[model samples]
Target: MTARPLGVEIACDGPTGHYDCPHNAAIRAQFTSRTARQVRADGRRDGWRARPGGLDICPDCVKETTR
Candidate 1:
């Protein structure tokens, strides 16, 4: 997942290397303060990306789900 940017902080356990997973992507978007969003997998090798949602509370929402 590619995030425009964010200003929030997040801690992941499953995947922390790439900003793809909807969970992680949410963090990057919320924390980094990203606007434009898009989630596309180039191929099997590539993972998923986070696209823009109607709301802004994303990463935080992810954290809540994990809990």
Candidate 2:
């Protein structure tokens, strides 16, 4: 049996409704190969929450955290 690829979910603490955020797009592009487990682990380590869904991150939140 083949393992299904889990959809990546982003749990942002900032503003909601980031469906059009470019940073979210970049994240999707950047971690195209990252498994759901990996993303969850990283989120745990970074104080964020990663689940399985169609969640997204906004550009302002990205700038605030990454800076």
Q: Give the number of the best model, judged by lDDT.
A: 2
| Cα RMSDs, all models | 12.0, 7.0
Alpha-carbon TM-score of each model against the true structure: 0.19, 0.30
Q: Which tens-of-lDDT digit does each residue in 1-67 have in candidate 1? A: 8875433343332233334344543333333333343221111113322334422334444454457
For model 2, the stretches where C-alpha displacement exceeds 4 angstroms are 1-14, 20-34, 50-67
Tens digit per residue, CA lDDT, model 2, 1-67 = 8997556654453534433543343233125436655555555555443324545344455455467
Q: Which ten residues in a row have the lowest lDDT in candidate 2?
A: 21-30
- Model 2 score (lDDT): 0.47
Q: Give the Cα-based TM-score of candidate 2 against the true structure.
A: 0.30
| Best of the candidates, TM-score | 2
Error of 2 at 56 (Å): 5.7
For each of the candidates, give the backbone clash count. 12, 0
Alpha-carbon deviation at 26 in model 1, angstroms: 10
